[model samples]
Target: MQATFLIYSFLYLIVLIFLLPFEYFKRPASLRKRWIREKFGFFKKNEQIETFKPKIWIHAVSVGEVVAVSRLIKELSSKCEIILSTITDTGQKIANDRFKNYNVKVIYIPFDIPFAINKALKHFKPLAVILTETELWPNLIRIASKKMPVILVNGRMSDKSFNGYSKIKFFMKPLLKRLTLLCVQEEQYKERFFNLGAEEQKIHITGNMKFDIELREIHFPWENAIAQPVILAGSTHEPEEEIILDAFLKLNITGSLIIAPRHPERFQAVETLIKRKISESSREISFSKLTEMPSAFSFKSSTSVVLVDQMGILGSLYRICDIAIIGGSFIAHGGQNPLEPAYWRKPIICGPFMYNFPFIEEFLNHEACIMIDKASLLEILKELAENSELRQTIGNRAYQLFLNKSGATEKTLRLIEKVIP
Candidate 1:
């Protein structure tokens, strides 16, 4: 079964290489590493660390996972030498920037081929391997388990993902059993993993690592200068921006509307949408020009919208928002993280697609957050904007919920210590 799975994995990689266009291959270095696997070797020569002895290796796939485990990384650094690996360039960038001061090495995870997995293991020789979220690379898990302990931290299994894996349960069962522990984010995820042949004794509910992120004070350039209520539409996707703009026009509130698209590549597209919606009387503000305006003028004028075209600023930008409309929920894209806004004590408004984050739904239920389905967004926005008392009440409740869930980082770090040699 393992041999057949390995053959199928190779075929899948071949299909991906052929189907994806050359231009779409944005990360040349990653592609090069994969191609090296097809030729003389699986892992790149440079990926091998000769002298660095890592106590633990943590794999975080992308930006969300990187942010989720960042606090845990800091806490675990005291006891172990941490090696962080990510598949995406954005994740690598975030990890490098965040862990620059610490004794951490960030590397790109090689392809999941057997040779690549073996090579990575032989070089790092980590005491244990920890994977964040739903990163289940079969070969990596199998090979790493042979030499050292392997665990999944902040593990979660969506119903859709679970169903997909169940089809290959014959191959998946052994892969799962090799894990030393499965630190799950929620009880439902824990139960689902167990149903899919995961050992019950290996699973534990550690809560979402995102809740573990500490809220830092962000000093917005307009913090003291602006009194106008700022409405932040964060991590928004296509079509949703149109809905938000229409709702914003209806409210006609005396404030700035900041739209931060989920992907940096969508900046120009979102900017175009905002330009089309804004009236000729209103001016759009850019972050670059934020310093030119006078203290009073920053809040006084009819600057209708601000487009956040850069990365690494959305979380900090949330500090200035009076109300937050989290994107990705409007359409059926499952939702983006809402905890950032909740941490900042801002009342959150999201669309109805939130299955990816069940804990967030629980938080919203307890806090009485403003939830608007795709159809009723306009009405919800108008009501929230008009009623100051209602918005503040919900905002305060959201912050209180954050305060209650503050210790997940400490809890997760303690678990890491138990596993590390």
Candidate 2:
């Protein structure tokens, strides 16, 4: 096993080196620098010479995971010194902004090479390693297991992931057994882990921490910004904007529309597409980014489509929407997040390809939300626009379900304590 992981690490290093040229040119400056520094275990000045008492290293890959572990990090920080690490620049930016006041030391997680992991382990001196959902790196976990507990928090394995893991049972068994603990999202996920060779004693079902979502749209002036019923194509993907824009023109729904593309890099592309589509509409369609609008927003009565070209604002934007069409589900990217709209107690609609979030099945099964193909999306939007009572019932049902599933953070904290304590 040791020999295999070493060879794996060597091959991985080579592959990264090979891809570096392309990545360096293509990615953002901050991201490229962060990736390079993290690849070689470069630590900042403050990261060096920290307090020596039992440090808990919390690793969340990006924004979603970083945000999910907020309550967990907050609760655990008081108990033990915290060292938070992320893989992406956006995640790093968000982590720094969110936890800037907190005493937690935030840094980038090194690439999964043995030497890089060794350097991180030496500097941080974490008493325990708490990994967020589905981040099972072989070399890092294998090395850390020797010095301290390597626990998996908010662990979940989707069917697509399970099938891939099952094929590599030989490599996975040893990796699974090294985990000091496993806090999974659902009971069914336990069986999937076992099939992938996790020890039964190590696994515990703890639901999703996302359900315990602690965000406030309390400040967003919905009444001022939203003149009429609005349809928000929140977190949309490539070509999704065109389809939804077509639907909006046809419906002539006499309301505002906001399309927030999933990636910031695509904001210009979406903006251009929306501008072209607005040419076909007889009703004057106004287009603007969130930043372009006035602070004391008074939305225009004429048909308007606002392209949300910013970050950390989408969750708050949900409060202003009458209906939400989640992105990524329409394409093979799986889905962005239907849960955000649900958090705002708004009626949500998504596409058929939501394999990325199978946990949402129970919510969809109970008809708390609607999932339709891209072709049928217009029909449902039209129906929901007309039927006030139906929209209220569906939104209320999803909201109730979201409230009921709120204790995962508490459950996860209890289990995590058993290891770090």
Backbone clash total for model 2 is 0
Worst ten in a row by lDDT for model 1: 283-292
Clashes of each: 0, 0
Q: Report the poorest 10 consecutive residues by lDDT, candidate 2.
A: 218-227
TM-score of 2: 0.95
Clashing pairs in 1: none
Model 2, span 1-421: residue lDDT tens: 8777878888998998897687667777756775677667877667564665568889999888988888888888776788898876667777888787776887878878878899888877888999998999898899999989999988888787888988889999999999999999888788899888999999999888878767765465434656467899987888888888888888876777899987787998998888888876677766777877766766555568888887777877888788989888888888876778888888989998788777678788889989889899889989998888888888988898888888999998888777765
Against the true structure, candidate 1 reaches a TM-score of: 0.89
In order, the Cα lDDT scores of the candidates are 0.76, 0.83
Residue runs of model 2 more than 4 Å from their true location after superposition: 30-34, 221-223
C-alpha lDDT (0 to 100) for residue 269 of candidate 1: 82
Q: Please name the candidate that would achieve the greatest lDDT relative to the true structure.
A: 2
